[model samples]
Target: MAHSRLQNINNLTTIDAKGAGIYIHIPFCKQACHYCDFHFSTSLKKKDEMIAAIITEIGMRKNELEGQVIQTIYFGGGTPSVLSNQEIQHIITAVYNNFTVIDNPEITLEANPDDLSNKRIAALSNTPINRLSIGIQSFFEEDLKLMNRAHNAKEAEDCIAAAVKHFDNISIDLIYGIPNMSNQRWLQNVAKALQFGVPHISSYALTVEPKTALYTFVKKGIITAPSDEAAQEQFLLLVDELEANGFIHYELSNFGKQGYFSQNNTAYWLGKKYLGIGPSAHSYNGTTRSWNVANNMLYLKSIQEGKLPSEQETLTLSDRYNEYIMTGLRTIWGVAVARVQQDFGQLYYDYLIAQLQPFLDNGLLSFKDGIITTTRKGKFLSDGIASDLFFLR
Candidate 1:
């Protein structure tokens, strides 16, 4: 792992300017949520073996990283919380043994409500895990039931209190703009999180992914399909409320109090390289991107046979520039025109300025210094703007 950001006050594109973040994916969930499509299994038959394999994978790939320092380690999941304290420690310890961890590297574990009981929370608090990303989704029982989430409303509300007693760097995830979720109810969810003093929150709209239970339910009329208008309204409401409360909307779906932005995810938005381990995990190193097999069983089997079950592609310069525009345009950081010119050359710079004229005239984009950023209205339609600005060459 190198530094996750360019902090040397010198060159920005130097390889060492950004250190790598390590993401360890755990493909086991206690139960499936109606809307989730991430790879995982309810079965724990091979859970122990899976842990060993994960640790082994880290050790084996240590050389691939060429002894780089790891600045952040994130255990994202089907539900990393499903792994016991000992299991979690094993994975962390293995990484420590194989790679050089940066001083005070950000170590995060994505957990759920049901797993945060006093005992379990205490066990986790005892480890090097300092941050928790809880899946609260909604604070209403009816909403929880509709999503078939593993935990109920009570669990969702209480888990944060328990977690806060142990860790201050807590981030709660919420879903707004679900089908028929009223503005008032969304307000209640936000208020509940703020009342608990959660340092960070990641809230998102409920979009229907293909082959998900939520998608099928909507198609069959068992559940109403998500509404774009309501989602947009709710998103606006969330942004206004959180910002009023002194939270910064650092990225599109994320809000952090003061300096608590998600370090691992920030590395991602800045186009830093990272190694993603486990089923369905993704890796990008500025030049290339790769992903693992989505099947847990197959993933385990492939790695066991001394082969990583993943596909890789080296990124073209255009691919990297387009990706930078796509991601950087979504955050408060926006796009630096000088940096763009330096990396992509004057031709790309001319192309970007040409594209910016309409958006600027429409009040959706602004120019200051040598950077171009979206206005508030631009954020709501960021995807379309990014599509228009993408360099196909």
Candidate 2:
């Protein structure tokens, strides 16, 4: 039985999806949020040039994943909605021209609530983009102000309603753990999202990253740091409410109705090959991971010179196993014990089992058959727990 399970896991190594996915990063935002530390520029002075450069980069890296179909295309970063409908279409056209894409690829755009006006939603529906991921951090005015979000309470509600009319495959982002956020407020936020009939929700607990305005505020006593207790309580509430409403906790931070999972993210977590285009974007092809230069000017100049402004590192065996463990523990898939043994060798499998004993003993992890997964108590702490299990080189 053990031999067969290990064999099946070993076979997963060669099982590639029909095609690779593409990620296009648009790293421009109109307003800088207080808590965000992602690489983005607030100025749109070079927007047009950036767009052209991204398209050019697409062509330059066309052969990176040759012989594979482009299954998913994701527009992420500062604010994908900042681009005009025509600008977006131009890039999509470039993609079609440069790559072999399927008839109906899953194309998603991460839009802000303020950008999803009725007209804009209608125009987007006409495009090939089949999914929308709205950044609706909160539906309350106080929380929005605290986060320095550009959109207000009404826009949050109105946009989702407007988006639902045109797009069925919609996902909205919500943030929890804001200082002074009561449990009741959190419940209301979740309820409002449910009222929208959105098929998917990607919610996260707000954290204070260094050098961000939020961190400075906390240091100056302007804002209270996020409470772990509150975050855990809110996360539990989210799981209970969403699961009751027929949403699967597909990934740690993602919930989707049946057949509504984000194909782009799923492909990423499954270790499928993907190409990322734009400043600060990252790409992976099963072994090597690469990231573009985070500076806008440098990226454009590099692309114009017909060179990629990116750095890549090939994965070692330990790196692959650790990545698999980290991502696997955060999703419903869990870590496949047999796969660890087959791919990383018996030493790794034995090491993993030994490392897992404490978590299993503490009821934070569970092992059944040949799989090891986080228990309900361990869900919120999955990342930390996975780290403790990492195999250091």
| Maximum-lDDT candidate | 2
Each prediction's Cα lDDT score? 0.85, 0.90
RMSD of 1: 3.6
Per-model clash counts, in order, read: 7, 0
**In candidate 2, where is summed lDDT lowest over 10 consecutive residues?**
1-10
> Per-residue alpha-carbon lDDT of model 1 for 1-393, expressed as tens digits?
111321221123422444788899999988889999888899989898889888878877887666467878999989999998889999999989988787777789999999889778877777888788999999999999888999999999888888888786889999987877899999998999999998789998898999899999999999988888898888889999999999989888999886678888887888777898888889877788999888888888988999888999998888888988988888888899998999999988999998889999998888899878888777777778988999986
- How big is the RMSD of model 2? 5.7
TM-score of 2: 0.95
Question: What's model 1's overall lDDT?
Answer: 0.85
